[model samples]
Target: MSLAVGAVSSSKNMGFDESKDSEEKSHVSESSKNLPPPSPTPTEEALREGEKYNRQMSETSLYATEEEEDDEERKIELGPQCTLKEQLEKDKDDESLRRWKEQLLGSVDLNSVGETLEPDVKILSLSILSPDRPELLLRIPEAGNPKGLWFTLKEGSRYSLKFSFKVSNNIVSGLKYTNTVWKTGVKVDSTKEMLGTFSPQAEPYTHEMPEETTPSGIFARGSYSAKTKFVDDDNQSYLSINYTFDIKKDWPSTS
Candidate 1:
């Protein structure tokens, strides 16, 4: 009886050991199947980095080429220079054309009855003259010189404003004169007068300034412009001119 019991106990211990070994082997196989892929080699990582750098360089080079092409497209090449003689001839032709137009317009008959009215009136001259000082007349300078209409106005003094016009058609119009001062502030003085039916055969009309007090604050030593407008019967402006002048606190000493 004792020997049979010993044999049975030995068999049971052996069976338990075999079962544990099989369970451990199955667990190891499952763990290996669930594991992530191995990391890339250093060489492979370097090759990928090199490829990315090459792609960036290629893109930058292509962009630079496109910008260069655009710059070339926008660059303008100047034409051949004209000869001095050619330029002079061109200027002469322009002057002749201008004179022809003036003469043709001047000869037109404007006083004929039932003739259509035209805004062909021309301002012959416009000036602000000082009777006391003949040299102080405001004059329009020719172009390419120091071009500006300038006058030196003395405080508390009066000036004469004159303007003349020539018409090529029978048009009833009026003169609207305006004097303004503007800098840090603005002030305006205006006057209007009727001019009856004007014709080319009529003499140029002239007017002088009326007696009036100059605005007090206008004599501040700065720059200002005086403007005049020629308006038709309906108050529509057809011609305008402006003059710029400076104001002085005191007149220059003659000595």
Candidate 2:
């Protein structure tokens, strides 16, 4: 893995590099790092005192991710699309291209191909993994899930988030995700990571974000709000959601 300061590991079979869709480069840090607060957006700057972000409800959201405003700066160029079958058939006369295509295809099941105009990326689940601790996996609903504090994390513990997803139809390019976290209406953390491009395959791909240590101390424990989004290079959003969670002194007992 390329080890993007704060991203996770992915197998070589996946696209991109350890820094492979490394599956991603991340912008994540604990509050203890004293990351400077995100600059206020123009729209945010114009809000009146009564409507400032600090007092906003979770539904209205708790942070500002400047990604949309600066899309072009972060955008990666994508090439013309070709189905795996078509690509495999093309330049079959060339030995080099054939070998390259073989490596890219990597035992991918040909029958899994589907007829669709655009690639469909389905996020299956999200999990929280920590050394010596049980995995906390969140089942993703097809639509919006009922909003609430779904789980708890032990403050100061090391943990990472993992995702499982499937892609069908055409190839999805620059697959990535962003996560922004807030506490008591103040933005605390944000991240963007590239999972790289992927071919439509029968099996789902799972990516685990690099581990993060939750901030501890008196002020860290409590309820928090988070917004997570999954999107592609073309700016297509597969999912965007607002949910709640908590960091506490101890993990919740399974019993």
Candidate 3:
């Protein structure tokens, strides 16, 4: 009986040991399957994923900012809106045309038909050359020799003279006011003479043509006046500008 009881106790202990070992092994296998890979830690994977997302977001934001900057640098104007350079160029063109119109309108310092008027040494000499058109080459004083307008007007005598003038300003309507009379002699009475003067009928200025190397200039008559002589060399001559005149640009520069 003792022996049999000892044997039964040993057998029970062995079975318990085997069952415990099997339970331990099964628990280890289940735990290992639930866990992730060992080489790449779970924390490292989370960190790497976060870094990749941040890099993609940064790249997208950088591209968007660059596009916005490019849009800001360039501006578009659809219609009528002029830029600064364009406005400046237009103003320059207008100023140039105004000066041309003034020059082409002629001056008020000239005498009537077949008369002579004194020339101002200061303002009259400003015109370097007539507004790029057919200009009558006036004889300039060569260093020492100076020839001026020398004409004697007879009392009660009516005459008409033609001269080549320049049109610097294009304002043809106000041609009379723009003109300046520099000199005038003593006035004489011509009450008995039936006088008739041929004023400027149209503008003497021409347009720019294709064959024209330089820009074609304009010219016009401003006014007209009569002369009444009182003295021999001091005869009074009437002077005026003819606003209506003709223009011819098919000519070359004389100077």
- The total of clashing pairs for model 1 equals 0
Model 2 clashing-pair count: 8
- What TM-score goes with each of the models? 0.44, 0.67, 0.16
Please give the TM-score that candidate 3 achieves against the real structure: 0.16
Better of 1 and 3 by lDDT: 1
Note the Cα lDDT for every prediction shown: 0.55, 0.79, 0.33
lDDT of 1 by residue, 156-243 (tens): 5667667777664444434344444554445444454555545354567666666443434544566666555566544445565566
Model 2 C-alpha lDDT per residue in residues 1-255, reported as the tens digit of each score: 358633533444345454533233343334436777678775745666546545666545654447654476457666777676776779999999999978876665656664444788998888999995889888676689535777899999999999899998777888889888988888889898999988777789999998889999989999999888888887888988888898899999988
Q: Which of the numbered candidates is closest to the native, going by highest lDDT?
A: 2
lDDT of model 2 at position 107: 65
Q: Please say which candidate is ahead in lDDT: 1 or 2.
A: 2
Error of 2 at 48 (Å): 27
